[model samples]
Target: MGKKLLVLGASGNTGQHLVKQALERDHHVTALVRDPAKIEIKHDKLSVEKCDVFNKEEMRPHLENAEVVLSCLGFPLQRKEPVPYYLQVAQVLSETMHEFGKRRVVFMHSWYTHPESRARCRGFFLKNFFLPYVIGQSLNGMRLSEEYLDSTDHLDYTCIQPAHLLDGPVTDKKFILNETDSCIADAAQEINRADVARYMLDVIDDESSYRKIRAIGVGVDVTDKAILTDDNHSYVPNCPIRISRADVARYMLDVIDDEGSYRKIRAMGIEGDDSYMAVIMEQIDEFKKVIFRN
Candidate 1:
């Protein structure tokens, strides 16, 4: 009971996960990449095709009998691609799919592409400088891509807008899709790339998600609970250390023990704000001063 899948941008980070995951699910996957060597996956059920995604005629043959089309196309935040390339890709894909009578399509986007989501972004530095300047140019392309998809006909399209991407394994952190203009998650929200792939694949077979534009947020269903010890005594530290779980996690793994971090505190967010990112700069500064002081 496996379906045929055509994946665009198969060489990219999130696209690689989608390609691999689809194969794991026993789907016959055809990955179209600019460079076939970039895919690095070989399976009897998988086929790799090298083509410019903007060329509809070249892509038409690959779309033949494809039950699902998943596109994880977009450049990095630090770099910008050429003008209206996102729009061009979507347009080409749209026409090609229509010609081949293929309909199910998934286009990757970001929550920041949504106006409301961008507005809701809390930090002044993030909103005023980082987002508007560093990340804004690329985000504009994603928005245009979504718009192009919206204009297409005879397609069961789902534009998936993921929150800020974090590098990690496929997490158990649950993902939710909201069909509104609001930000999918709070300003502090960060999702693993693999989880974003998981959700995209999840919606492929789901008929209910067709024709919907949704923003995806990770860890919304997670709850914080204190684990009780065997003894009836709560282990209380000498001083109450209040730090956001995420802020502490930023220093987790090798980051905490790295020599580079020994006497320094990674300043994260500000205090007394309505943002999900609470004051961690002050706490971390004090912790370093007290523990690593000369």
Candidate 2:
């Protein structure tokens, strides 16, 4: 069934794709943005609403009778203090979701935020000297957003994670979903914004994706030894439970192509290893047996 959906960040790299895709599908679409003048989508089905996400009251009106909410919030990478901004947006969304009785939410997060997956890279100079501040800020913000999702026990929500979101073109491959993240994946992973938008819409259209916080990474098309050659996979490691086998196989394929990640695993526990890979695969391997045993 097609229901009304709201996108928090309507004017972004990924958000534009999302808006266009939704409109093309004939879904009831509302692009909630901070600036109304910048609305560029051209569809009779698309409705643009201007509101500051920082204000709860300003955002609630847009959530009226909404079935799903997608937030591609354009959070910057440089901030002296950012946890407040993170929590504030989440709080506003939570309040708005509550007031409007919206039961579902789908948001985005980075790959490393999972505390388990190593699906991307930052290089030596970046990780050691620069990206930490931004990554740390994002983590802080995601923590609050994630906490709200967790605490909102009443909403059917899923947090979508993309691995090293690159502005490159989209590639159709496998998705990595970690079931029991005892350790991070042993491969390299990268995803295109278009792919992320496509996946987000897929999740919204189907209730199967509700109530789960997921991390997504794009992989090259590969043959899954477990399944025959004519099926699509859907597995996503570094995600919460409640996934399927088809997804598992798909995720497996992505990991298979992840070279940068594999090297990090061997170097996961080295003391002097600060190759960005070492700290990147920094999540504890609490889910190894469960993930690989079956």
Candidate 3:
């Protein structure tokens, strides 16, 4: 049987995939978005609600029947206002869920939010320059949110951290899972938003992943894929480490009822497999055709 799911940030890049994929798997989903029009799909099992996540009163009614809460909340690249937005959302969700006796929660975070990630940043360019200057505020908010979640004992929370996000298609490649002090190589610094969503859903009910932070990236080598550089594929960047958003959604739905993923931080990266890259390229090529209308 499909679980009742309450999805926060349902209009964002990843949330859209999550909502669509969940419905495809027969799960009843209540998607909370700031703008209802942004959700293009209409299904009887899907409920689109327009409400601020920080508003507990507005969110209380939605929590009544939800078996699980999935947060795909994100901030703009240069957003500085609402100083600690992620933390505030975490607090609101925690309070509301506790009030309604809901226990399972999954959050989408970043690899940079992990404590060991600082060392993985390596050199001055990333550690000193990029992180602090390029995405400083957003990173700070994620870190704070992570810390707050870590301190909470009542909520069964799992934070899935993905490295640089890509808008690629799902390759169905097997992911390599790791935890604690695993350094994601430069080649593995990217994963499709879809795959991250997959990991989040997979571990949803798994007790092994509860209260844990999982970091993910794609580590495949696609040096020989010619389709990546083809002229018709301008949007799909010529990169080897590609995973799709659709696949991510597929993964999440697969594990929403499993018990091994609860309270665990499972950091994931794609295994180095050339065959997988070949298949991924084919999907990307097809995806490109659809985008270019060729």
Best by TM-score: 1
Tell me the deviation in Å of residue 45 in model 3. Answer: 1.1
lDDT of each: 0.72, 0.62, 0.72
Q: Residues 99-126, candidate 3: write the lDDT tens digits.
A: 8898899988777765456766854455
TM-score per prediction, in order, is 0.73, 0.67, 0.72
- Return the TM-score for candidate 1, rounded to 2 decimals: 0.73
Give stretches of model 2 more than 4 Å off: 79-82, 115-127, 179-188, 205-208, 221-294
lDDT by residue (tens digit), candidate 2, 1-294: 567988878888888878877876778888888787777767777889887888777776777757788888856543354445656776777777877677878887665554333233434433443334445556657756776677876678777877656676655655666433311243234578888888888887567677666766654443333321211223222222222334455655656877744643221111122333333344223122222333
Clashing pairs in 1: none
Tell how far residue 152 is off in model 1, in angstroms: 2.7
lDDT, residue 64, candidate 1:
76
Question: In model 3, where do residues sit more than 4 Å from their true spots?
Answer: 77-83, 122-124, 225-294
